[model samples]
Target: MASRDEVECWLTDMDGVLVHENHALPGAAALLQQWQDQGKPFLVLTNNSIFTPRDLSARLRSSGLDVPEEFIWTSALATADFLKSQVPGGSAFVIGEAGITTALHEAGFIMTETDPDYVVVGETRNYSFEAITKAIRLIVNGARFIVTNPDATGPSADGPLPATGAIAALITKATGKEPYVVGKPNPMMFRSAMNRIGAHSENTAMIGDRMDTDIVAGIEAGLHTILVLTGISDQAEIERYPFRPDEILQGVHELVENDPFLAEIND
Candidate 1:
């Protein structure tokens, strides 16, 4: 693994490492500013495919983080990238919002219901029964199944809401065909983000809060991994995972205050 000082690019989870509940975490602003001031290559990543990069950037601005749309990468973008590579100018029957649709459109993918190349599913609050039924029928008829993420549930003020994974399971049961997930824990998401920044695995670092998704994917991608305690994974939870991150901290604040990478930049 690359040491902190050797790292030249960064990939960080958005919700846990930088913001939570639409609020920027401690040192989150400082860390981002420091990266920008030094012209460091970095990208904020998320599994949520409900919002476009522009939408996420505005949301981060509302949280007091000045991340731009180009600096943000989402599962939808990665999925689009993958599909474009596999089948240029392909078509898909999609069940998602502007995030997924816009990305596919930008990739030159056609959105159609008739004998599409793939059945793409993403995160959305409104999971219409009719839409899901159509997706199932298409998959059964030989359309390839693809999902943005494997998150079974998403957090909300009320309770856990069914997410892409849950819906994917339903479709899988009906069609007896599993989807190719293109988000965290798959390592393809991190690789796609790195490719966007022209970063190599040997010199890239990933900072995240979840042991299962972020840390595991970082390790699989061969990037330096740092686990923070501000979100889902706790010390006890870390033990449950067989693998471990290279470093652990209370939050991004510690990186802002004492990271050797920042010190090297100042020097």
Candidate 2:
């Protein structure tokens, strides 16, 4: 376990730990500001691949959070980074929004549908049947299937919406190929974020709400994990999971009160 004074970096889930229901969670903004004031490196991680980092940063700022674009990491970015490492300048048939498209482009991947190297799927509000059909055809043509995340559903103002994992399942059923998911619970996403910030797992801390995705990934990545109750998992649900977080808090407010970054502040 990493001590409070030993933590030199922070990796946190964006939706649940920092903001929920389009509002910043209690003490989220203050804790983030404190991290910045103390020059602690941090990144806000998310499995949602609908929006680009800039778009997510704007959303957070509007909701009273102050995370910058560079501090935000998405599953799309992780997928792109992984693809780039495997096959540089590859072509992909993508079925996602600006987030996936932008990340792939920046990573030197060419977006194509004419016998591409990969069929990449991410979250999108416009999950068109035509696009899915194309992705199926591409996978059938020997293109590798990749998905941003394995989350079956995502939260919304209305209700839960079918996410990338659900859509990836449909594609898998049609093509008889399982997608390589690169998101939370995979640990690849966490390791990629750690590499991005040049932080070691022993000195980094992770905060999240979901025990399945966030906490499990953190544990696997060898980081101290804190599970907050502001999002998906509640106290009762946590008991069902065999894994556990290093600490549990009601919200970021409690974390602020505890002052995990006190050593940095004092320094």
Candidate 3:
């Protein structure tokens, strides 16, 4: 693993590493601002496909984070990029919110339900039975199955809500076909973000809270990984995974206070 001085680019998970339940962790914004002031390349990778980057930026700002839309990369955008690469100007039967649809549109994909090239799914509160049935039938009728992420459940004020993975499972059972997951743990999204930022993998570092998704993906992408214990996984849970992060911290606060490279910026 490379030291902090080797990090020329940074990628961090949004939901946990920087914020928890719509609240910013201590020093999260300051750390991001420091990176920005240093002209560092960084991106906030998120699996939430319910909102576009613009919408998410507003939400994060409301919670006291100063991230801009351009600095945010969502699974929806990655999925759209994948689809565009696979079939340029193809159509899709989408079961998602404005995030997914907007990305597809931007990628030159026409949205349809009848004999589309793909059946794309993402996070949405309005997961209707009709939509699922249509998606299943579309897949069975030869449309390829694609989902934004493999997250079975998403954090919510009311508790865990059935996410894209859970809904994708139902459609898989109905059509006897699985979906191509395009978010974290796949490494493709990370590669895309790195490319978008024009950063080499070896010079990048990923800071996240989850071992399964964020850390694993970072390792797979050949980037240094840092796990923070502000959200899902903790020190005790780190032993459960065969793969490990390059470093672990209490939270983003530690990075701001202790990282030598960041210290230079602060000084």
Highest-lDDT candidate: 1
lDDT per residue as tens, model 1, 49-165: 999999999999999999999999999999999999999999999999999999999999999999999999999999999999999999999999999999999999999999999
Give a tens-digit lDDT track for model 2, residues 1-267.
757678999999988789987898878988998889889999999999889999999999999987889999999999999999999999999999999999999999999989899999999989999999999998998999999999898777799999899999999999899999999999999999999999999899999999999999999999999999989889898999998899998887776745554435557
Task: Please identify which of the two predictions, 1 or 3, would achieve the higher lDDT against the true structure.
Answer: 1
TM for every model, in the order presented, reads: 0.96, 0.94, 0.95
Best-first order by lDDT: 1, 2, 3
lDDT of candidate 3 over 1-78, digit per residue (tens): 568789989999998788887888877977998898888999999998889999999999999998999999999999
The C-alpha stretches of model 2 lying farther than 4 A from their native spots are: 257-267
Model 3: lDDT equals 0.91
**Pairs with steric clashes in candidate 3:** none
lDDT of each: 0.95, 0.91, 0.91
- For model 1, state the Cα shift of residue 3 in Å: 1.3
Better of 1 and 3 by TM-score: 1
Cα error of candidate 2 at position 43, Å: 0.2
- Candidate 1 regions with alpha-carbon error over 4 angstroms: 257-267
